[model samples]
Target: MSAEIKQAKCIAVLGTGSDVGKSVIATALCRIFSDRGYKVAPYKAQNMSNNSGVTPEGLEMGRAQIVQAEAARIAPHVDMNPVLLKPVTQIGSQVVLLGKVHKDLSAAQYHREKEKLWDTACGALDRLRAPNDVVVLEGAGSCAEVNLMARDIVNLKMAAYAKAPVILTADIDRGGVFAQIVGTLACLNKAEQDLIAGFVINRFRGDIALFKEGVEWIKKKTGKPVFGVLPWINHHIPNEDSVVIERPEAKTDPVKTPTVLVVRTPHISNFTDFDALFQVGGLAVDFVEHPIDLSAYKAIILPGSKSTRSDLFWLVKTGWASKIQAYVKNGGHVLGICGGYQMLGTKVRDPEGLEGPPGDTDGLGLLLLETVLKAPKTTTISRFEWDGIPGLGYEIHMGRTAGADRIALGKKSNDGLLRVKERNQQACTEFDGAVANSGRVMGTYMHGFFDSVPILKKWLSLLGLNELEPPEFCGPQGRDRQYDTLARHFEKYVDVAAIVKVTNID
Candidate 1:
């Protein structure tokens, strides 16, 4: 490595705009460097997404970093992502610092508090960089938003703070690759531009030779090396935002395989929980928002949400509530998870105005239970049993639910007859959600319910699809394989030697 390169130990993957594959590139680099026997760690000063997962220590961080951590063959820690902004409203978000809820702030309020948050972010970065040979830093959104640059703590500012060379990534699939690279550089001041070491063009299709002139243009225009032109990789990488769900591709016929539809709520959270189902061979999972005929699908899943009450309000307003009710009434299997579980209850009480206004909202009334939004959010990596089958999952929610009526229970208890047992290091007898007497509808607080192979098999059988074979790998193991596949694909296209030189790795 060059003498100047040896001074740097971290490399920041900044993007020209949001969803331009910064996370994907960072993850690839983490795995690529890790494969070279370097002690690597992934770092993100701040992440704004509802797609999050709890660590083994019960601490929470964005799922993207968690995937990156796994790619680096390391345990995920909250310090990797010091600040997590979960948007609960259009203008406001629930800020999480060091895996705990710091506060809820509006956009302007959050900017005003950037100094304190910046210190925390820097401290986290330092801790991550101290032990690892290389810390792959991922930036948020565009690095050159002039209006937000003064208060920005996640992009070029973070790169400067960490003394890391920046690798700008742009998605060619979005078109205007040249404009994105040149325009972003034009927006940056000279000092900021100096931090950039190179650029990577992502999601390119067709012939690489055709893009030779394009690459030369960027290099000539910006005086930065075009590290690589990554082809559009068709892989199952967990998404960091809900925007992908909004523009899903057209669905196909299930054709003897079981079909499942997930109610795509307005404020969906932890949607990656369904990734396991997507990998199964004989299952078709689709996200549906508008009212549609649910009779074709074997099961309908109500996914976790950041704002349960408001999403439930949207469900009712958009006519999905009545549609789901009719589907379930017609013997269609329905599974409610987390916020979805809360929405299935008789009422949801938010007296502290935690989620929204302090009041009660009418639920879908599918389950005879009531949920009360309370303090001390529950975050745990739980081992549980579903219908006598072993299951593993995590819980991240903001409320406690109980049976609404004792007489309605009949032979069942307040926890209902679904019979779920959760173990968190210590074996504790705790009940989660309820199952209807009809046995067609079930609800649970666990997010990764479908990850359990036995449980998934049983659920498929319940949906009348018993001929399909179980996937060889599911859950964590399956995800690890995906990371490796991603690394190999990028390794073939990306300039690993250049990246190593940039990181000062000898």
Candidate 2:
């Protein structure tokens, strides 16, 4: 699309393992490049798994790319996430376009269709390269799976096609960070290996002084510079992968502090919906395994689930159904988003297994309506004004609910959906422990609703809590100050300047 294809510079970030902080590193790199005044874009050729977001153009992309784009302070682009596969079953998944699910196909079935997806990926990357000084590409999972490597469009093939240099990141905490990097290089074909510029060691939890010998061992083994040994940052960062976000055993605080239980279920996508809750002061958030008591919490929330029927089944099996109902019956507040919102209703129907074949599943009976899964999924940003709440939030969930005459969280536009209306609504509305119905309970499909001050305050008031202060916006000054804070945390162990130097404009 541009004459500068030959001149445009790019870099690919690949991980030695999943959940090794590759997305975190890429976002940090975006901030670094953006701070230097270079036009930068973040890209990921193909992203499998669930956890998607709708772009400004009304197209769908992975949520991780959106975070990286925010780091660059750019409007999210669809081409940034060329292919998204949201699994509907163990072997089958729904193929998505820029933001909507186009069709459902098995893994083997989808491979046959990848050529068309690859063409779209290339087109998106080409557009990203057209107007930027640098495009940082993030790879999915390990690049060493030889079997899947042939079909891989997100990692090596994407790097080759983009003509971008690659930097492999291996997790030192996994043990054998050296072997992971070396084994990866050994596995790749020579051309793929040649694309690598160097590697970074991520999530090192020990004394950096102790790793000097191992660092030397890696250098002598691969002859490539170990760019940085980054220590783990305990600071709050967005969890890009839903799987990691869903399980918080390690990150969860063990103290018997005031706890809010998140009911875990099958098809749980977008667990990041509760990220703010995780950091709420004077409160602890934990995922309750089955057979656990729900009566112990001051509040309970059911997050978005991919399969309403299956997750509802899980709720029954885990005995959380009766427990949740009992909690509400005893005057506790319950909140649900997306599929979780559906489960809070009267009933759910799937005639086709868009989640599964033909059945009507009973809801938790928390809300008054019913939800029916449709052939085409509903994915969009809902802007609404509810009972006086304001601010701008987005909705990217499927299925529809009925029977509730009014929205408790947000109002509807002509387009029809709930979104943030006021900035302080999240804080003011939920402060000092205020509950909507008081006797029953309340919830909405809006994810970032609590980010609003009023809404947050009102919700907290219902539970007898108070907000210390409003959350800082995720803008340039805010992110800069936050990232600087993060950098300081890593200053003692990580090679901060070296990371910036690796991504610096030439």
Candidate 3:
């Protein structure tokens, strides 16, 4: 609401801490404003995650922004998320600036370059705001980290730059709701505290009336409005980070449905690929960290990973490798995707040290293929088919795979697919992925492979779960519906009119 802020109005959602629902709140705001006839776009200065998606221009960014773009009914762009940090090791991360890999930098080295990166982030935000009616900026992690405040470009600094009003969000489910908000405000200086328009409490379970006194106490203590208390939603939305996997859900009876176990690796990436699988009736998807009895499940899935070699090493060291092999020998089916695909091959060579130290490692040897981790990464919106079943997916990988007697999953093309669109208007006709001669094992570079209805149906049938029916909506259509539902759920709890007023949007 400052004269310096021109063209688009901006409102930022900053969390008290990580996984406190900043992305979800920002996403709802995008859809709400879009529904109100405003052209909305989402911006996150820096995102640290390996769960990414490719844009129509064949650029890569965090998948959370892609979901936000869809909620706004617009095409996604790299400008929406300028800096992405993909942790490849305990000490270092692959820094992606403006949708491309800039370099691998350690924590200390990355901090030294913050000044330059901050400028880049600001430029991206300016570009995003230029053509939009409103830009919903999302802050990463805690907005009140005292030590990181000076170096922070995503929270208060970015908000101050945009002259955007901030709505501090906290998860009541995490407990200490009072302390969470009060302590956060206490950490900020007076000017920063004044920037906060109000507070939104998320993930409140149980009776709302029971918390009325608590809400009143917070309002009086902070001298700020409590916008609303959001109830925990049971629906599935793609998580911006993998931390959600640590918070376990209520156990479901495995006997009622055929289960698919996903080997939860240390560095899991793009695990959202299984979101579609979770929706299929009579099928349950579980992420398992320890080696479990695979006999109870219909099939096993090795999801994508940031450090393929390291995770593959984990599979062997943790006893999952032997268990998976035994399951395959018992005539069980298995599917490996991206880094997982690399692990299923005969050998994986990282001679150039793309993932780690220069060397070679033996794969699970399920497929007669070899993978070489080499230079420039491949990121594309792809179209393909599997056993004549049309499919749509995207490929994001850094290695070239080769094999003979490989059953082609699909030949990539510019057309003839259901969901994915042609990138850069170019036609491509390359074959991707492979299937074992035994037909029990398959591997693909494509993420979102199961998003295709026909492919999901066929795969289920192949796994002997023929009785289960595919959901009414699948892929993009289904995902869009979920976003709309999320928006509605959020609106029911939050004060939308007050939020609009706070943004000073006409």
| Residue 135's lDDT in candidate 1 | 92
Candidate 3 per-residue C-alpha lDDT over 368-464 given as tens digits, one digit per residue, 9 for 90 to 100: 7878887798888887767666777888999787762321332232221233334344665556777888888988888989888888999999988
In candidate 2, stretches whose alpha carbon ends up further than 4 angstroms from where it belongs are 1-7, 242-255, 385-387, 404-436, 467-505
User: Would you list the rank order by lDDT, best first?
Assistant: 3, 1, 2
Better of 2 and 3 by lDDT: 3
Better of 1 and 3 by lDDT: 3
Q: Count clashing residue pairs in model 1.
A: 0
Root-mean-square deviation per candidate = 3.5, 4.9, 3.6
- Predict model 2's lDDT versus the native: 0.71
Q: Which tens-of-lDDT digit does each residue in 157-232 have in candidate 2? A: 9888877777899988778877799999999887878888787888888688898898888888887777778887
Q: How close is candidate 2 to the true structure, as a TM-score?
A: 0.87
Q: Can you list the residue pairs that collide in candidate 3? A: none
- Write the residue-wise lDDT of candidate 1 on 82-189 in tens digits: 999999989999999999999999999999999999999998988887788889999999999999899889998999988899999999999999999999999988
Runs with alpha carbons beyond 4 Å of true place in candidate 3: 1-6, 242-244, 247-256, 404-424
